[model samples]
Target: MQRQTLRLLSSTASIVFSVLATQASAQMFNSVQLHAAAPGQSGGMLGVAALSTPEYQGSAKNRKLIVPVVDYQWANGWFAGGSNGLGYNFSGDPKFHYGVRMTGDIGRKEKRAKLLRGLGDIDAKPEIGAFFTFNPGADTYFASSVRYGAGNDNKGMLFDLSAGFTESWNRNLSAGASLGASYANDNYMQSFFGISQVQSARSSHKIYTPKAGLKNTYVSAFVSYMINDRTSLSLIVTSDRLAGDAKSSPLSEKTRTSSIVAAAAYHF
Candidate 1:
């Protein structure tokens, strides 16, 4: 079973803890001026938010979900949480970092949408990858990551490249924006966008095969306001467009989708 509700709840708890830990650490150590200049919070932070995203790649329908955002970093570089999962920061310089990590692959479940019918469900699995970040200057960075599925459910490889900029407008207000793109291997394309003979027979769609190619591109922005040192509120907006074979798949309902997320994080 997917245990979607349980997963969301657990993730929420993790994000809350991370938020509190990070906020508390900052207030305890940094001066007010220094805090305002920082790019991101330190230590663990937890956040809870409602997210709206496509029910599946190419689907026009959207699903609103509650998610917990969690991130943590240790002095020695070993840490876990967020999309990066468990990893160690190998670079000694603050401007650059690289590390390997393992993250959970939350595959698609057919129950979420009608378009997924006849396409066999993909199981939750694991992926291992290496990530690198380069900070060109204060509040700006470029990053890339590549991962390969280590599980049977979706044994595919993916690569992502992105650029982001963050700024603190005032002591209590900060914002960031990012643009990114992704590439998927044949396995990934086939699993999510390809139509098997059985699926074609079962559904009203024709059999189709998608090859390896660019998958999607997206742009996102976020703003956060600190209510106090221990708590904050944030809103995020994102828009994405399916490309290559993914856009042509009969399984895909729309070429573009948008999402908004609102959340609060508490630091202890």
Candidate 2:
């Protein structure tokens, strides 16, 4: 089992605005989403975390990420800092909230692969875009987002679509499940999955180029329990598999990627 535990500090501040009013209550949403975490509250937090993932998207080697978690948000809909990048919510309705955000794209860095020599490296970059969330009822929601690369590392865009439903198992415990798919553009496909003639001359695999298409499909389930007025715990399990040209890439391990995350959070 992969687990992480930490203590988070949360604080809230009040700001007067002429055009906006703050809601009195904050609702917890999906924190382990594929595209973005749950809607944030007007507060701040700090914690320790551990994440298990493939060294690259398809490599068999697993790397465990142990890092500090920090986040902050303002009541005016502006947020910054964290693994999810930064963005602001400018508009919404009873059923939806519209916002824009960005995330870091940790590109490929593989070593010890004789077949990958001279393929160089795909530098880490930032992906920025907008999103919308639809709350159909008390127990169900849907979300979609599109982000484009903002750095020189890669110049492709990505689209993410997802849906989820939650069940209240008890007064303090709840469980939710989500399904999602991500699509990539030709530049992204070619950058990550396609093999060029220059690369082929230096590797064991033949040269190949891939077209834009669905990159992966995934499902995740999580259970969260409120420990007290200021604390909570959550466990998430996720699995994903490559699709389209991503699955057929010579560099792909073609195995399903799975991860387990356990989180403890505090609210103010």
Candidate 3:
């Protein structure tokens, strides 16, 4: 266990350094400009976190801080952009994950204007993008993810569609809920659901499979408060359900679990 923990830490640190180096050398394109209406236009965010789950319970502790960088450019009414994010969780259970995403717009300025007008009454605008994720602990408890989104408000997919809404009562209070489903690889499913092989030495059984299905469907809720313009706190809870052959695992009896996360984010 100690060796495994150390390995996880070392891998995470390597990924962080690589990402930082890449960002430091990144150059802005001629067409790129900051969004006038969005925060973090310079496209970077740093945060500290404390997260807890029923599986690992303890006080909030120090977690690695991170800054995500985004760059955007536009030409002939079309837009292109890319973003990179890094974060770490270090407390009861130590973990780190990061990824990059790219996006493109396929409409003319007039089309964009029409779309914005249609969504003006709505609180959220629609976006489409693809993302890739990496998890070094694929053989262990952590499973990485790569996903894509389309349609209005990042919704509408036959297998991985998701939809949600968020509202802020004031600068310090806000809440939102989301529901989504996706088809995942068996190994990834197993990792997320905490399924593993058990060995019984006395029984002479070389290996035994736990009876439980891996979870696939995900539901989540979140609330956040902004202490100030550059600093804010937030909490998130998520639940997942197992699916297919994975549900047959003995450990699948308890198909639901929740996690509570508290985080503070800063912009630079």
Best by TM-score: 1
Worst 10 residues of 2 by lDDT: 16-25
Per-candidate local distance difference test: 0.62, 0.56, 0.33
Q: Residue 73 of model 1: what lDDT? A: 61
Query: Per-candidate RMSD vs. true structure?
Result: 9.7, 9.1, 20.4
| Best first by TM-score, ranked | 1, 2, 3
Q: Give a tens-digit lDDT track for model 3, residues 1-268.
A: 3332222222222222222222221100101111211221223344544544322101022122244423222221222223222211111112332223232211111122221222112122233233322223322222233333322234321123344444555545666655554553443233222223331332222332332232245566666665655455666665555455445443234445444455555433
**TM-score per model over all chains:** 0.82, 0.78, 0.42
| Residue-level error in angstroms, candidate 2, position 97 | 1.5
Residue runs of model 1 more than 4 Å from their true location after superposition = 1-42, 150-153
Which TM-score value belongs to model 1? 0.82
lDDT of 1 by residue, 31-109 (tens): 0011111223345556677766566667777676776665556666666765346776676666776887776566777
Q: Number of clashes in every candidate structure?
A: 11, 0, 14
| Arranged by lDDT, best first | 1, 2, 3
